[model samples]
Target: MAGLSRPLETELTFPVRTYDIDFAGIVSNIVYVRWLEDLRVRMLERFYPIEPLLARGEGPLLARTEIEYLRPVRFGSTVRGIMWAAGHGRAVFDLQADFEVAGETVARARQRGVFVHYGRMQVMPLPKELRSQMESAPASSRQQGG
Candidate 1:
């Protein structure tokens, strides 16, 4: 698989477990959503740990997701999941992810998420420290060599 070169991309490899497969013997659609969530967490952990975010009573909450299923992934398939911050507004940002199996794209998803004040349950801007780090992070931080 080609290494992602996007300015804020993260890639992680996973194997399709038996439970991930559906009655059709292909990986279940819901499993991809879980994979995308994992990628999102990994991306956030790169710049800011969840502990600090929680300490500030902030939470990254998913607002919406749009996914397209291309090819079916079978059990035991090795998939490389890729995610990146496509864009952001004041309190909401867009994330894009691709699930590739054996060099073929199996699925793609776009997600919108918001930073919210946990207690207030209201949207909030991303942490300034995290925003700065994300904006100025080195290229190495963007691409993980597979």
Candidate 2:
């Protein structure tokens, strides 16, 4: 049996640029997923620098992802991106992301990833140190609707 899991939290703020808007004048659906992906990578980098992981010949790889858009964000709006690890087991970790504007959540996402030994290209357990780092971090602020 796997031990209890904790969520790792991170927050990011950025302005919606013209390039991210769609024909309807709101953020494109695809862009939301992109933002979620960026947030996940950034969160990992903040807790465990990716460069060092690469040097160690081990890195996390996205195994699957899902996104749900609750609202649209228009160009010029300031949006906040938050990410967290939802669960962790022997070989995989589930991550979640939320996008917000003015304290209102605009979107949410989930991703499952596996730690891999790069050279061998094999799935591996998340390092104990990395898991401890996640467990020790405080949870992110909850969105108005979340």
Candidate 3:
């Protein structure tokens, strides 16, 4: 979340739904988790389709999430979320994401997790195709934040 940031690879816009509002009349913190899920799915689809992963009984498992809320987001406001892959290890992968309103960041988050074989309940290496995509990309364009 602090070291580096890069161009967004998967960007999506969302309407701040009524149900997202808290008693304080602002978007609740829990809503950000939903948005993060959406962002992650989009990122996966862009680099590696979920269908293939699921077919192989492989899926990502989130181990942790850290969010920094920078500003209040109110209901009815439009939010633009940008997600990118930050780094990878033998099995763990890092993701960074930000929520923007009118070009200003309202929140940012970092997620660290790994892909696992569902039936075996074991960790799997980052998909080769997805890893190749990142390796073949220019540094500036490599999926950097999710």
- Global lDDT scores for all candidate models: 0.79, 0.77, 0.81
Taking the tens digit of each residue's C-alpha lDDT, what string does model 3 give over 27-122?
A: 999999999999988777766888978998999999999999999999879999988777666677777888999989999999888889999999
The lDDT of model 2 is 0.77
Evaluate model 1: give its lDDT: 0.79
RMSD to the true structure for each prediction, in A, is 6.0, 7.5, 5.2
Candidate 2 runs further than 4 Å off = 1-6, 136-146
Best by lDDT: 3
- Listed in order, each prediction's TM-score against the native is 0.86, 0.82, 0.85
> Where does candidate 2 clash, by residue pair?
none
Residue lDDT tens for model 1, 26-129: 98899988999899889888756788779888888998999999998888789999987766655666778888887889899999877898899988886676
Model 1: weakest 10-residue lDDT segment is: 137-146
Q: Tell me which residue pairs clash in candidate 3.
A: 83-146, 84-145, 84-146, 96-146
